[model samples]
Target chain A: MSVAGLYNYWIVILLMMTGFYVVISSGNLVKKIIGLNLFQASVFILYISMGKVADGGAPILREGITHYSNPLPHVLILTAIVVGVATTALGLALVVRIREAYGSVEEDDIHRQDESL
Target chain B: MIGTQLPALQVVVPLLAAPLCLALHRPFATWALTLTASALSMLVSILLLGQVLAQGVIDYAFGGWAAPFGIAYRVDLANAYVLLIVTTISTVVTIFARRSVASEVEAHNQGLFYTAWLLCLTGLLGITITGDAFNLFVFLEISSLSSYVLIAMGTERKALTAAYQYLIMGTIGATFILIGIGLLYMLTGTLNMLDMAHRLITVADSRTARTGFAFLTVGLGLKIALFPLHLWLPNAYAHAPSAVSAFLAATATKVAVYVLLRFVFSVFGVDFALGTMPLALGLAVLGTIAVLSASTVAIFQHNLKRMLAYSSVAQVGYLALGVSLATPAGLTATLLHLFNHALMKGTLFLALGCIAWRLGSVRLGDLKGLGYRMPWTMGVFVLGGLSLIGLPLTAGFISKWYLVLAALERGWWPVILVIIAGSLLAVIYIWRVIETAYLSKTNKTAGAGEAPLSMLLPAWLLAIANLYFGMHTGLSAGIATQAAAALFGIQP
Candidate 1:
């Protein structure tokens, strides 16, 4: 495949890897959650891109339309977006609790505190 | 009508009850509703299992939209067994939760706890039963979200960190699964598992399909607690409320395994997924390391709950081992272990919950001489521990025997040695607890009595099940073999 042809997938992979790295390497609890959201967003982009067809419009009933983007991935990603929102809300809530308990959200601080315990 | 709707009702009951539980501010009423809903789902699972056995796979399409267009709840021999395991454990844990939750959670938060518990159950059951790949992701998120909440509710503040860690790992896993499913949909243009299976056979060698398979395995590996990706499990289990730990230990990973089985054998075809790739051998190596390393680490844990949590990761290794064998006997052993391990771990965790109920801690030091103080509870723990050690006349032995037999069939004698060594490690860790509880002298100052009957009954119920299923393997082994055969495309 040409670079132009595969550029979309390349972007998706790059975004996903960056998000995964941020999650694994970040000490800040909130940063890790943001990384998670980024990772999921990359997946959403990949699905939506795959759904697209050349010169296609929204998947709706049109008399003159010959091609339409695949709608299934869009529907599936809609559900996934909701799941992502729920996860973010829950993650933030946990971070709040962690901050309250440890007085810090950094992984290093939590570890140090726990070790002292 | 009820029989016809059993598959949908199996998950829907708990799903609906979760909202009801949250809305009902009365703590007692919520607990009662959660318990009743769990029991009802368990009954539905039993009926579903019977129907699957007698009539074979039951396919129920949502809104009568038919497969490939709408989602389907497909109950074959495999997932029916899983559904039974999930619901049975949930029922037992719910029965035990009333007293345990009352003690661990603040009175006002009790309703929310029960709500999350039921939602988790619904998510697990839904993941086990759905035939649509996308539906599986939705259900996975439901269960995972609820689990984070449940773990966060632990009495200890550490539970928050554990819950956060789990949320991060679980979301990553779910995202990878979603990516895999999306790739498969792109390749096959179908989301229904059976349709995907049919479509995939033609393009099994395609690069996209191969990439999708890899993504699915790694993604699920994280969720299934497969060795290296299992860092989240120990803390999550060690710090969650006892009832949540028992419930999750007994059910969540088992359902994840069910999903792995569906993808490997049904969607991707074993020959292409395992045979073409070295996936089986790779999994076998990872499983061996998981078993050996986790068991060894478990031996050094000062906290009893953490030790058991490590042991759980080791147990997951055994499941992965069975999957790696990639034969009917191997699959059978995996399925049997799935059921057996749930019984052993459920019983052991519940017993610990009993101790936690009476003493407010499960530290090894705190448990000294509990043999005299809580003889019945400790006795149940002993039986459960023996099962964990794979001793004769316990549930653990039955699955271990099958695993050994499967390894021998493949002439993989080193795996047999690995299994034996793993058990020896289990013996050491389990014996540590026994030594602490039975051999050490009791601290007479703190007047701790036996755990209440409500707690004792459920723990013993599972303990007895461990022994009974070991002695009488007809049900578990029979269905497991049938499920394996079905996976291999054998009609019988």
Candidate 2:
């Protein structure tokens, strides 16, 4: 395969590394969650891209359609999407609790407060 | 009629009860529902193990869909062993949770707390029982999200931050695993683990397959809290309420270890993972480091709960060391320690729950002269502590004895030395509690007395189990050896 054939994978890697960098570098709690979302989104894209077939129509079989993209990855990603949403909601709920308990969502502030205790 | 449905029911019992628990407003009602679910699951797990030993691996296809197309639940000896461990610990901790949760958690929130705990149990058992790779990831997230909720419900404010940090770390780990599974699905075009393993053979030498393995290893290494990726463990264990601590500490990581072994030896095949990849030496080196560093760190902690948390990490190191050996004997040792560590840590954490119930603190300073005030409670603590240190005639020593035997067979002299050093470190940390409780002046008791019979009975159940299993190794060690041989695809 030519380098041009791997375009989606390059984008996947780029988005993944960028999101991972934000998650690791950002001290703000909400920002880290956003980065985690981005990281997961890249994986969704990777999965979706892998399921495509050249010149394929929708997975729904029709008269005269000789090819179709795999639908299993789509189905799998839907479940992953649901799990990702649940994780985000739970994470944000914890962030709300953190803000209430430590009076700030900044990592440094929470650490100092816990240390003082 | 229900005999054949054991695999699905092992998880569904807890999954269905979680929502019912959330609906029940009374704390006691929710606790009863959760206990009922775990007890049923434990019974099913025992039957499943017996069935597995009798019939070999049992495959249950969902919705009547066969494997390679529909999701399946396969109960081999290994799955039954892990399922039994998770269900057993969950059942014991559910029994231990009534008073612990009432005192530690707010009354209004107890229903929701038990709901999350039930979901966590569903997830851990589901992960161990499923034969589908994608299904395992879903269950992993289920357990992790519920654990975050459970951890955030701790008594101290720091629990909030601990849950938040774990959420971040755990989510990243889960996503990495999702990517790995997706890659495997792309190459094999099937999600069934056995089918994937069969398909993976011809493609196993590919770079993509190798990348998938690396990703899976790192993700699971995070889940296992292996040495480098272990920062999230101590705080998560230390800050959670004691019942949650006991249950999660006992089951979650052990389940993760089972998954790791399954993916490595079963899915990837031992040749691709350990033989081709140099994984044996890498895991051995990291396991050694984790044992040395985590054990040394445990001795310096002032909080007894946090100290035990670090010890949990070191115990995980022993499991990894056993896996690194890549022999049937080594795996048997790992399996034995998996159960033994759960016994010791479960007892220790439950005992700490009792201490926190009475004294309202678990710091080293609060333990001063506590032996005289709560003799039975402190006696349980001392026995748990001795087991943690792997003293003779205890469950902990039985596993360590096997671990040393394995190392000696492998001619890993340095690992043997590390094991000795790790045990010495455990003695120092455990003896600190004993010395503080018995030898100190009697000014720091806080006027507390023995915990309720309800709590003491459950702690002693596990403590006595530790001694019983230690003396009669036939059941624990015998089954572990059989399961280990099966995993290695050899005759016991």
Candidate 3:
């Protein structure tokens, strides 16, 4: 947990916060979905980083391979990736529908239209 | 044969049915399939609950793998009770959805609605049954994704926006949960909930575990619509199709509460979750704020569904308050309310759906003289409202009474006062509905009539359940106490 060794987590945290901020602050629905994706990608990285064992080989058993990195997180992350993709697709489709409904995907415009209703 | 596979079938029946529903592409057939799956799930849940009651905790490990190495379905009193509540609500709502969906969704789209319905059902039951942390996340996403679709299927355009909003929020909540699980997995090298609980004890004092716990609480707080994080709930519930609203309001947040309870008591142990982290005080304060603020907000809402949506937030506060008290009695109150609130809210929302089906809207203005036109539907609404107000001989009173008793046991007089004040606010809001429906005058009511028996029957069924459970505490309270004991890690 030295300063140099901890930099990876720091970067992951930075990316996660940035993604969260964008999702919260952005007015456009598409940008929000991208922000969500970025946030999820950072989590994937964090999980993968935790699974890494120093000098460890891939989890597959092979001749002369004594140390193996954890494989479970990778499998879990694969499932998570599928979920994230599904969410993004759903979000994008909603954005398309929102455009059809409100004639815009921007939050401000949608709000104004809703108010006038 | 079915006894052994009940845990797996509880989820698989609905999971498999979703695609079958989609493939069938016939509205009537899909509805029939959804109804059958829901009924089957409900039956299995009841059987599982009976097994748990008779034989103690039932643990079914998948594919013959044991414990931490493979996923497990662990059913004790707590989860068995949750499973029953969720499947029962689904069964009832699906029965109620026949006319609701036909009226709200286009004929071509009804199959998709049933598909999403079964997926959501599958996801909810899976979350309740699974003992693995990662498996819970998978199920959470499954339910969430399908719900977003279901919400967007509303007749109103704003349903899209509400679905989008919930998508962002739900994904954030799920991601935070994933992070927490990842950190816990890193520390313990196990994704199994029980193993993590065992391992977490040793690392309880670690900064990493503390961070993970924080992530978990906030994530689940959002999912449970706890107080300040409840922004997505009102809109999502209000704008969704009436069947979706009734189903989600009744089961979704309740399941989230179950997860929070599992994490707090069973997984983290109450000592760590409540004692160490300032979580108890935070939850209590937030719950108080929600009860007061949301109820006050509810009183002002013109839309009946929106009003009930806000009231739901307030009811969640009562559950939070019980959890914050961190006593067996307090947890019992929370569990009892979990069941009672589902009955009350399900009935209320379904009645509103019936109103909407007849009148095309549930705005307070439109509801004028509804009591005269649709006496049965309005009568159901009145019963639900009474229960919501914690009237004597209604299920709501039992939960609030238990909460008050728990507060008294702890000598928390102010909390007792807060609970009473919250109920008063509920009375005010419920009165608004009654006043608009029964007292206000309206014109052009000749075409109006009772909601079809299809809708009214299911609505009255739950309405009567509200009264039945109100008088008969043997089932709800008895199971609640046993579940609470099990949650506290006692074998009783």
Tens digits of per-residue lDDT for model 1 on B263-370?
999999999878997789878999999999999999999888899999999999999899899899999999999999999999999999999999999999998889
For residue B216, model 3's alpha carbon misses the true position, in angstroms, by: 0.6
Q: Give the per-residue lDDT of model 1 (tens digit) for A1-117.
A: 689898889999899999999999999999999999999999999999999988998899989998899888898889899999999999999999899999999999999998898
What would the TM-scores of all predictions be?
0.99, 0.99, 0.99
Candidate 2 runs further than 4 Å off: B444-446
Instruction: Candidate 1: give the clashing pairs.
Output: none
Q: Where is model 1 chain B poorest over a 10-residue stretch in terms of lDDT?
A: B438-447
Q: Mark the regions of model 3 whose C-alpha exceeds 4 Å error after superposition.
A: none
Clashes of 2: 0
Off by over 4 Å in 1: none
lDDT of 3 by residue, B76-153 (tens): 899999999999999999999999999999999999999999999999999999999999999999999999999999
Best by DockQ: 3
Which lDDT tens digits does candidate 2 get at residues B1-492? 799988989989999999999888699999999999999999999999999989898999998999979999999988898899899999999988999999999999999999999999999999999999999999999999999999999999888888888999999999989988988998899999999999999999988898888888889989999898889999999999999999999999999999999998889988789998878887898999999999999999998889998998999899999999998889999999999999999999999999999988999998888889988888888888888888889999999999999989989998889999999999999999989989999875456778988899999999999999889999899999998998888965
Residue A29 Cα positional deviation in candidate 2, in Å, after optimal superposition: 0.5
- Give the share of true interchain contacts found in each model: 0.97, 1.00, 1.00
When candidate 3 is compared with the true two-chain complex, its DockQ is 0.97
Per model, state how many residue pairs clash.
Answer: 0, 0, 0
> Residue B288 in model 3: shift from native, Å?
0.2
Model 2, residue B214: what's the lDDT?
84
Model 3 chain B worst lDDT window (10 residues): B436-445
